[model samples]
Target: MVDDEDLIAERTPLPDAIGGRLREQLVFLAEVDKLKTVLRQSPLAAADRRENDAEHSWHLALMVSVLAEHSDEPIDVGRTVELVVLHDLVEIYAGDTPLYDDAGRESQQEREEAAADRLFGLLPADQAARFRGLWDEFESRGSPEARFAKAVDRVQPLLLNWLARGGTWRTPGVTADTVRARKAVIGEASTPLWTMVQELIGEGERRGWVSPGE
Candidate 1:
């Protein structure tokens, strides 16, 4: 139900932006600006409005840089940060699928792969391949940096939920057991962070911010 005013600005002439590879890069940047409007289920700390994909990516990069020391294995902090940045850029087109949305999860892979193809193709060929490689690395979580990046990615929502007094924890059908099961991957990257996440869930349950048990 978006009105004309709510629509994103029309893509017009490049104006004075320039041309060639720089123009392609500019177009890609402009396209990803839509990520700022693609909202996620998680609320911001203020609890006023839900956070968007761009903000989420930015936060993940910052958290990865700041918390690299907590990784279970040594990771290239710079590489992990780049992974986080590229990870959600696809959501600019595929949209943010909430972690608990079973219906959405069914088609998530297909939709996102298409998005990656189209969006990353906006860049020059070499840059597109490199960016797509980084995105795939993050998705695979095979590398140490990817694993640690994922750990922080999972933890950020938990922190937001705790801070916002339930946040998505209060969503129907979300419970302590579910939270723990989904978040168990955190331990694969950082033992201490996983322990802290468990503490937060325990406290959340006691405070009635999260459902108890399953």
Candidate 2:
């Protein structure tokens, strides 16, 4: 269990002239503010604008809280939320790679590893270690929390694309087979959620919002 006092301690404000661990924490916070400017390919459910990295992370965190019960394995909801929220912070520098971009994915891990070093290194030593651990765990998909967080991350964009009538799915190279291949990991975490994903994809295809499989 996480200590409530540790959470409080982490949140306590630092003085303006502080020049040690507190300064590092503040710098990390300021640096992460750029995540709000990194736009993703998916559009918002109710708006014309694309969702940004910060908003995408926030949404996934909330989804983890609300959808934890759907996980096939028991999970720590709070830890899952933390994983989801922190998973994409590296994208502020690495940029959001489109899900189906095979060329971009070839170098995505290398780019993100560099981004993680710079971004997480902005924190004090201990805090940087903890943040990197969370980020790495999410990337590895090794834990139940990581698996569920990843499932939600994938589902959120699928949901948005369905609602937005194909949204980015209408891009030239996107196809049903490619989407299914990319999203198959969701099934490993939650069959229920994966079922919903398939249903949405089927409906989108029927509506001409998603390209039919070849």
Candidate 3:
């Protein structure tokens, strides 16, 4: 009779024939599939279900394509797309933190940094370094591409909140001031987009979807 190790090996043959880089890439790809199951706080645009990190990353990448022109400083749109796509990958392990959770925000960086170390480490060394750099750049929000990516990230949830008639904003303790404080950086990237978001926030307030100032 076949032993347990033999049975396990038979069920999942090692990809020894593939080149080392390709094998590592495949492993990284399969590992990141967990991102799809990492639920976020924001609801979907078309459905009541909460969005996942993978979906959020895809949406932010698409936003970079369409909104790059609006960035206050000229930016490499491709780099911006890359930054946005990889920014939240750490969330696959760190889990999504609510924007308004003050206690969570205090420890968020530490948690996400650890998550980045683990998740990005799954890739081959060079690729892992590149991805970790992208994640750090996005966190820093210093480069034009990073700033643009951050603006798009902030805008997405605001748009979803508007679409859902205040969606997560309807939660207790969330106020117009809280949103403005949290998303103020968006104006630095695109005043026009910030203007649009402010208008939406006003509309939400008018409709009683968003609470008044704290």
- CA-lDDT, candidates in order: 0.88, 0.87, 0.85
Check candidate 2 and list the clashing pairs. Answer: none
Kindly provide the TM-score of model 3 when superposed on the true structure, using C-alpha atoms: 0.92
Scored against the true structure, residue 3 in model 3 reaches a CA lDDT of 32
Q: Summarize candidate 3's per-residue lDDT along 67-167 as a digit string, tens digits.
A: 88898899998899999988887886788898988889999999999989977776789999999999999999979999888999999999998888888
Model 3 worst lDDT run, 10 consecutive residues: 1-10
Ranking, lDDT, top scorer first: 1, 2, 3
Clashes of 1: 0
TM-score, predicted candidate 1 vs. hidden true structure: 0.92
Better of 1 and 3 by lDDT: 1
Instruction: Give per-model TM-scores.
Output: 0.92, 0.91, 0.92
Candidate 3 residues lying further than 4 Å off, grouped into runs, are 1-13
1-214: candidate 2 lDDT, tens digit per residue: 2233333234665666788887777767766887899999999998889999999999998899889999999999999989998989889779989897889999999999998987787788898899999999999999999999999999999999988989988989788877888899999899999999998888888888878988
lDDT against true structure, model 3: 0.85
